[model samples]
Target: MPALLRIGRTLRRTLLQAIPTVLGIVILNFFLLQLAPGDAADVMAGEAGSATAESMAALRSRFGLDNPVLVQLGHYLNNLAHFSLGFSPRYGMPVADLIAQRLPGTLTLMAFALTIAILLGVILGSLMASFAGRIPDRLLSIFSLLFYSIPSFWIGLMLIVFFSVKLGWLPSGGAGTIGSRLTGLPAILDKARYMVLPATSLALFYVAIYARLTRASMLEVKNQDFVRTAYAKGLTPFGVTARHILRNALIPITTMAGMHIGGMLGGAVVVETVYSWPGLGRLAFEAVMGRDFTVLLGILLLSSLLVIIANAAVDIIHAWLDPRIGAR
Candidate 1:
């Protein structure tokens, strides 16, 4: 009960700290949008083709563009308090609704990509650690470097060319079979099929980071006194390595995973665009291009919230894995 109470206190404190962080992000994003050149109203006007002064004024008033920046910020914050993200002038829908529509695709893609990264990274990192100073370790290091250095967009295009264009084994762009009505397992499989290339591209860079971090961490943990003690206590080599070395090394890997959430989201912008996948990243691209400030801010705030939550979760996991963390 005391431990649970401690965790509760930690969560409460973390949430209180997060409130100010979120407000600052909101304020900064609002001002940044204000500072950005080009008028959203003008963008709408141009798209409509030829606008008189009256029409322009009406457009500004309709979108609340006529309001002073401070008043607009106040209104935005007021709407946020009521669980509103404002309406998107570009999509002609509530920003929250537009985000809701795109959230599933982004979540799916990120889920697949992060899973691949974690699995492959842990495996490769273990291999490197087990084969330290051997050819296998060197080769894995080189492979990690290569993937880390390559741009995700380029990797995405290459995957599309090979898997979708040449082999025709998977989709080149977009989500699922275009215009085909699929349900149940068929729908899931179709979505996965379309997701392969983009997910792989997004995963590659993270894989590199995780592999390197894990390998270094494992090597360090392997030399620790606890690991030596485990081996001395009649534990099998595998047991000592797995229970002592790997488990201890995982603290750093867990930290990286938490940090990677943000990077993966940013990388999604490129991967989604390259593959024409209908995710938040692609929506963000369209929003920026159309000067859809509301949508853009909505995405930013949502992303920030996810990152904060992920970090808090990571801290809890860390405390669970090593009770010493709770003291810290």
Candidate 2:
């Protein structure tokens, strides 16, 4: 089959696979939130004071909490069908609107984090691979191991202390001062400065794994006949590796990186919460705590969609990078 035609077919298949995953996430999260102990109205009133039957009944009616679980779920599905996310009980706003408000901050944070992971991980991995079996390689290997095992929260605290307290360079904890918000280039840079520590800490885990993956893949690819053939033909080491080694080595790393992007974007709750960044993670955290089912379901569903879309992207990339893959 023609390469372009083959790629189209593969992409179609990939997107088709993603549909079921999206549905599954919606169904599962909705049910789990429903199954979670305590009724929604009760959760709302529990923190307020005593749960009078009349007041409780009123609260249930107010939120349509009187409906049977199945009916409520059916309504949810119907609302979802109409592309409506409904209002968040906690935020007293549409879940969709809340997501829109916070998504940019979350995206801004995750983009920097992804950038850090890719730059450092690829560079470190390439260096380690080039110097395989040497002191530099061993040291990097050990460092990657250590970085991978550390908890993000612990790393955040350490970064705050050593960088913020000891050196007095970065902020200790939080996104920024309330009134100091700026924009344009200077504002962006300043935000990045506040962002550097948490982004770095959040990225460390992915970087360690990706670096290891890259180093190993590159090292193995370097032994291939195509790479050696390029070298034997008097191509410069850099030229040969750039054209040959990295091309082949990037296949696995691309998959790993793409899949991780969704997690980093969606599952960044801990890092976001630790830094008090006003993003989806922190928002989702509050939603779950308050048993704001609408908000929680929306975030969970959005996260699941990200993961599915990410995987579809990875598959498309895989087919592009390695035409031999699923090329039948």
Candidate 3:
């Protein structure tokens, strides 16, 4: 009961602290975009071709772009308080609806990418840790360094060239085949086929990071007194390493994994652009090009919320994994 109470208090405090962080992100995302020249009204007016001054003025007025920045901010906040994400002037649809439409694709991509990263990272990291000072460790270290150093966009393009263009094993771009009527299992397979290149591209950098982190963490824990004691107590070497050393090493891995959620989403912008996957990142790119402030801000706000939630969940997991964290 006391532990539960402590964890509850920690959660409450985390949430309280997050309020100011989220508010600051909202302000920054809104104002920074506003500071940039041009807006949805300008884009709309220009796209219309030879529009009159009065028509441009009316467009600005219609989208409330004529309002002062602070006034617009207030309106946005007020709408947010009412659970509203403002409409996108470019799309003629609510920003929330647009996000909802695109979110599933992004979620699916993230899920596959993250799962692959974790599995491969842990396995490779364990191998490196177990064979420290050996040929395999040296080889993996070089591999991880290369993976970490390369840009995701470059990796994505290279993957497309090799897997899609040369070998022709996968689709080069897009979430699915264009103008296809495939359905059910066939549709699922088609999407998965298209996903392979992008997911691998997105997952590679994180895999490298996690592999290095896991290797470092496991090595750090491997020599700890508890692990030595466990070994001394007649525990098998494998048992001491796997059941004890790996478990403790995972704390830092968990932390890195949770914190990387935002970064992964940001990276998706590049990966999705390269792959032409229609996810939130692609939507964000479109919004920026179109100066769709509502959709852009909506995406930023949603990303911030996801990051905060992920961090909060990490804190809770930390507490569960090591009760001392809850007490702190």
Candidate 4:
């Protein structure tokens, strides 16, 4: 089959598979959230200091929290079918709108972090493999281990102190400068500056993992028959390493990176919280705190969908990198 045709088939199959997967996630998340202590109504009432029994009942009814568990689930699923993520009583807005407002920031942060992790990781890992037991390899190994051991939030804090407080080179928190009307390149640059710390903090741990994985993978691939053939063909060391060894080693690294995308989303919660970045992570945190089940459910559903899409894209990339995999 043609490559594009195979890719189309794979995407179709993956998306079809994702339907039941997303539905299951939605159902499970709804039920699991039900096990929590209070609903949105209860949280609202509590925050208001006091409410009469009759008023509390009305509040429950207003938000549809008065329904039976199964009934509530049906309503939620129905709303989802209509592409309505339900309404956030806590925020007095549609869940979809809230998510729309925040999704870009989260995506930008995730992209920045992932890019950093992959590029730095591959370069460092390549160097380490080249050096093996030399001083360069030893120093990088120590650096990777140290970053790997430190928590992301602590890293964010330290970065904030050193870069934002002491050096005054970056903003300490948030997605951008507050109340700034800057546009064009200035606006883009402002956001980039604010993003550097949180993105770096989130990327550091994964960088360590990727670096170690890449080093091991490259070393293993270097000993392969194909690598030996390439070397024997009189290819320069750099040419053999880059075109033969590194290319083959990338399969495992790509798979691992794809799997970690979802994990990075989870990690963003802590990083976002630490930096006060206004993204889906921060929104999810707020939803949890305020017992905004509707918003929380929306976030969870969307997050799962994003992960699914990411994995599907990875499959396509894998197929492209190794046509035999596509033939499968």
Maximum-TM-score candidate = 4
Best of the two (2, 3) by TM-score: 3
Per residue, candidate 2 scores C-alpha lDDT tens digits across 21-139 of 77888888878887787766777788878878899899778777789888888888898999998777667889999999888878778888888888899899999998999999999
Encode model 4's per-residue lDDT on 53-163: one tens digit a residue.
Answer: 899999899989999999999999999889899999999999999999999999999999999999999999999999999999999999999999999999999999999
Most lDDT-accurate candidate: 4
Q: What TM-score do all the candidates reach, one by one?
A: 0.96, 0.93, 0.94, 0.98
Candidate 3 Cα deviation (angstroms), residue 204: 0.6
User: Candidate 1, residues 221-316: lDDT per residue as tens digits?
Assistant: 988888878888999978888888887889988998999888888889989889888999988988898998999999999999999998998887
lDDT of 2 at 240: 87
RMSD of candidate 2 to true structure, Å: 2.1
Better of 1 and 2 by TM-score: 1
* Per-model lDDT: 0.90, 0.83, 0.91, 0.93
Cα distance off (Å), candidate 1, residue 159: 1.0
What's the lDDT for residue 104 in model 3? 95
If the candidates were sorted by their TM-score against the true structure, best first, what order would they fall in? 4, 1, 3, 2
Candidate 3 has its poorest 10 consecutive residues by lDDT at 319-328
| Reference-based lDDT, residue 111, model 3 | 86
